[model samples]
Target: MPFLIVNTTVTFVALLSFRLLVKRMYALVSNSKQESYNVLIVGVNDDSIALAEALSTSKNQNFNLAGFISFRKDHQRIKILGKPIIKYGSKFYDRIAPMKITGIIIAGAQLSITQKNELVDKALANNLKIFSVPEITQWTDKEDVTSKIKEIQIEDLLERDAIHLDDSEISNYLKNRIVLITGGAGSIGSEIVRQVSSYQPECILILDQAESPLYDLELELKEKFPDVHYEVILGDVRCRERILNVFKNHDISVVFHAAAYKHVPMIEKNPKEAVAVNIMGTVNLADLSTQFNIDRFVMVSTDKAVNPTNVMGASKRAAEMYVQALQQNDNVSTKFITTRFGNVLGSNGSVIPYFKKQIENGGPVTVTHQDIIRYFMTIPEACQLVLQAGTMGNGGEIFVFDMGKPVRIMDLAERMIKLSGFQPYQDIDIKIIGLRPGEKLYEELLSDNSTTLPTHHKKIMIAKDKPLDYNIVCIHMEDISNAADSENDSFIVSKIKQLVPEFISKNSVFELLDKKINL
Candidate 1:
């Protein structure tokens, strides 16, 4: 009995020692991680509070939430997480310069451009990595917390506020109108449908070749807007008779034509397919809209059409020319308009999803060219601008959204990597693959020949360009369409260049076709 009691006591003592050692180690780790980062929050508003909370909760051992700072005098006395807010002036930086501040997050709301620039400049001068929270409301709970905290991008530095549209005007045109979206199931087309539904359109006819996505969108719209009438038609834009039949049956008053083969690499390999859809499909819709006496036909175009370098761009340019030519004809009742913009951030084929997939797969993210740059807008933003353009269209006019400045693809990759909570070039390797077929080093929003005209909305501008002759354009289009039917790729591409002399080919395997077909 004595021996058993002694053994039990020994075991108890060992367990206690183990627990104490763990506790000490844990406390040491926690203390080591508590190293305060000299963080400077720009605005002491809700965004600042949320950012403070995020910083406090972050596991980064180096981060220290120093204090808050804002240009507004009212925010000076405001306390974020019990830290006093400091004014971002000369003395403020001087006072904090002594302390090692790893980074500065500008959470200012409704800040003037000059004020934002001053803060950014000061942060940079202090050798601090700068970040800006555009508005507190932009945040969502589901957002990746780390990724949401991003470096101050050029968009943030521009200090331009988001354009506010005249909702009444949009509602006037869209409400109770039978709307037809050709690529209704696609990223842009679906978004158009969504926004139009918000206006309580009389009926929405969603036409797309893709069955699964079309079905999904149908169900979603049906569930989300039970009061709105929705129709999902499984038909390709390439089918003229089918598209016309739908227009005739539904009496679609407003047509949002977004269907096209837009993937550059895929289109480069299948130039014929690109021509059939982007060009012929567009022509079919424009003609049907006019035939059906549609009120407006808004064709979704791209920056690629500016000076097309690939089959996809060339096809889109041809489509634009077709719509423009139709608009020139006095007989056509439909007011045709084109909305040209660059890549969307979270679209089906956008790089954001690609990078996300790669990151989730624990793989090396692939970037085409380190120096390549392109304009980007959120999917919803692009669609909203499209809807706004549709309302502002007088006819034969091309509206381009102010996509701000172009973003370097490499820098975007780096930011995304950092946002993913991984040290770029350390945790995730970014592989620079050469530019793909029809891809550009940088995308251009407006050509030298194009001039901008202001609209009611600040973000949207009208591109002034000479209209093409409808008769001549139609003749060339007919020839191209005939060649497409013959499956004679060379004849079709050649005729396209003859119509619009700007078509150019890049990264294509068809060198013979490329040489023969010069725009």
Candidate 2:
């Protein structure tokens, strides 16, 4: 009886100590969280629950979970982790500051664009920063949960569902192959370099004229993809001797030809540079790829290439024709494919960043035309589609991506202002400037004679290309190249028009050339 009493006493003391320890831990957690910035989590679903659980732990260094924001009014009764979920409304907007909320974390992928816009406008008004969890595919278990919450980007707002990719096909084409990406320092080319590196290529040859951007890309690749081998060549695509040296030195199997003059207004002003770079640069690559017997040659073209109205567009179309015609040649063995896409969302000099800067300046935002609309895809999406197209093309095909509903420039400007915590026209005036030279109100993916046929990939389609005669295309391309050498803008543009009969100049001095042709 004495032994039993002694045992019970010891057990009781141990239980009491354990309970005290639990109390102490709770106190510490409470104290630390009090010192942290309080954050509200939007959309309390599976994703948000995971985020909340992570933030609840001591591992989250920056934020303390305050409450949840519910999209549905009925979700108010739902309590997650002993915290009440408040329905988002006008009342909630007023309570944001009072609640000590410093930030909002959007975790719902199903949230519509309209809801996102409303949330952004309200959050910015409250002087709160907005964050979002990255897509599930973007993170690994080893990655820190808090680090995955990134600032909500404008690309996230305009982008659609993540595109489906055929991993095996892309890997098969890119893996262990020596890849050459022309214009590798440009926005599109840089993204292509980043994406292709993930596929484990043999070595990536980054050829470009821009020294600073190329150096920056090298630093990024070393940090992000340390294992990927790359060579940065400071050379222009316009130089045949320089290009020939690159081809001779590297056993380049795959060519992603992204080198070209893209700005419509600038290209319209100097048609010589347009023809030299867009036409002859493409010609040099195409000829070299065929001569060296490269496996696949993929050229990145623009939607403006269809029924081109500017020197830039016309030149791109000319390049597209030359590439298509090469595939028709019985003597050529290389497969040349072209992928045409619309405006990349945040590329250099794109309207999104331009508007963002104007909004930051706190004044009038410029819109070329009130009715102008354009389809946009994120840079990564465009590059991903380019890779997918590269894998599927047999030869002589122009691939077009299905860019979802076009966005109006006027509406975009207003939404941007509101999202920046200001009222449009009241706080920031939107001035309508007339269309610049060679600018179009609408862009078309397919021409009158061409029709799209469905590919195995749902998002990509093959345009029934009417390939120009190989010999005839070569002769005209050579003539344009000669005119470019003479630095004759009118003569070069005339040759381009003759080469691409669909070419028509708009809002440009070259409109007079079109008139002359008609007369």
Candidate 3:
């Protein structure tokens, strides 16, 4: 009886110790979180409530809802978890400037760009961070909550008012159409196929030289859009016979030409290939479209094509000129249109994917230059604007999408680092590497001679740039093609400049061309 009592007493003491340890651990964790953040809510609405609730539930996020603030007089003054709603204007911000407010969350209906700017400016001036949820109806709410909320980016601040598309018109042009996309396995091409498939295209012919990616995309599309007819063809666009065969075999009605060697470094090393594929390849497809009487040919061009500085850009500009030239051809039964835009957010070789891979590897994310900036759009938005441009085209027109403001690469890298749940400099280090060959510090949307005309879709605009004379352009193209065929890189490069005098070489051995040409 004595031994039994002793054993029971020992067991009871151990249990008590375990309970005390667990209680202490819980207190430590709670105190740490309480020390981390104090968040202020502004413009209470559904989004604000959702954000508040999310913060309340997340143990990892150390946010304390300080209270609410409003500019309007009629909004409800309800307490969220006993937090009071206070009316604050410019003076209130000054009063709370010294408090431990980590950030302000703005949520409500859409506000004018001017009003939004004013709010953001005030927050920055007071040394406080600001975040906003998209207006009620426009909110996608797609991002994972684990992703840290970011300050309002320059893109959000400088972009114009959102433009709504006429859905019926877009649907009418895409529905039941047999669409052919060159480079269909690539970034822009794949997105075009995806979006078009959503609109119930009768058949989508995906063509690319890369066999494996083409096959993979084919399988994915087959599964996703099982009801839509899909075909994958592996062929080079530079081959006239192959392009003609595909068009004839498929009876392709709508064409999206997105195939080209786009990497600046690669193109500079082999200028002949750029000319062969970008210039001659485009001509082959344009001429074939005329022979086959394709309904629409939408050519994807880049912002680099505006006063180009590299061989790749020059070649694309030449392609654009060729498409414009073909529009004047009486033999072509196709309506040729070109869409010009800038870098996509997560393209195959884009910086976003590169940064993501770097982050996953656990260390430093590299930026080319601190001051370098470029226009950006999401892949879906870029592809959607392309479709919108195609529907609004009048044969020879060049459509440019409004890509909002240019974002500095350094800033983007920092934000991406933060979004990945790492604090810049503390968790992940950023290395500033020098710019690559033929890379621009900033990209421009318009040329000296180009001007914009508003479109039915506010995001899409028409470029009033001069179109080259078809006869002259054709002669220059023939010379370029012969030079490429003969493996003469110098002659081909020279002819490219002659065709488009705006071609300027940066960080290239071909800089001589820029000095020689007076345009």
Per-candidate TM-score against the hidden true structure: 0.76, 0.86, 0.76
Steric clash pairs (candidate 2)? none
Model 2 C-alpha lDDT per residue in residues 1-519, reported as the tens digit of each score: 999999999999999999999988987787676535678898777888888887787465678888899879899888999887988887887766567787888884857877787788668777787888865566678977877887687777874767999989999989999999999999999999999999999999999999999999999999999999999999998899999999999999999998888988888899888887898899899999999999999999999999988889999999999999999988888889899999998899899999999999997999999999999999999999999999986788999999988989898898788666678999999999999999999998999889999999999999886998999998998888888888668888898899998899899887888888899
Model 2 TM-score, all chains together? 0.86
**Between candidates 1 and 3, which one is better according to lDDT?**
3
* lDDT, residue 209, candidate 1: 96
Which TM-score value belongs to model 3?
0.76
- Stretches of model 3 off by over 4 angstroms after superposition: 1-43, 50-77, 81-160, 219-224, 355-370, 414-432, 486-488, 515-519
Model 3: lDDT of residue 324: 93
- What do the candidate models score in CA lDDT, each in turn? 0.80, 0.88, 0.81
By lDDT, the better pick of 2 and 3 is: 2
Arrange candidates by TM-score, descending.
Answer: 2, 1, 3
Q: Which 10-residue window of candidate 1 scores lowest in summed lDDT?
A: 152-161
Q: Which one wins on TM-score?
A: 2
Cα deviation at 411, candidate 2, in Å, is 1.1
Model 1 clashing residue pairs (backbone): 36-64, 37-63, 37-64, 39-66, 501-519
Tens digits of lDDT, candidate 1, 1-519:
999999999999999999999998997788687533566776766777877887788655344788877667787766768887777665886777665666887774546777777766656555577776546566677764545666665435443356677889899888888998889999989998988988989999999999999989988987889999998899998898898789778867888999988898888777679878999899888888888889999989999988787778888888888888888887888899999999987788888888978977776999988889888887788898998898896799999999977778887776666555566788899999898977889887777688999987889999997878998888988888887777766676677777767666666554466576442
Q: Which consecutive 10 residues in model 3 have the weakest lDDT in total?
A: 139-148
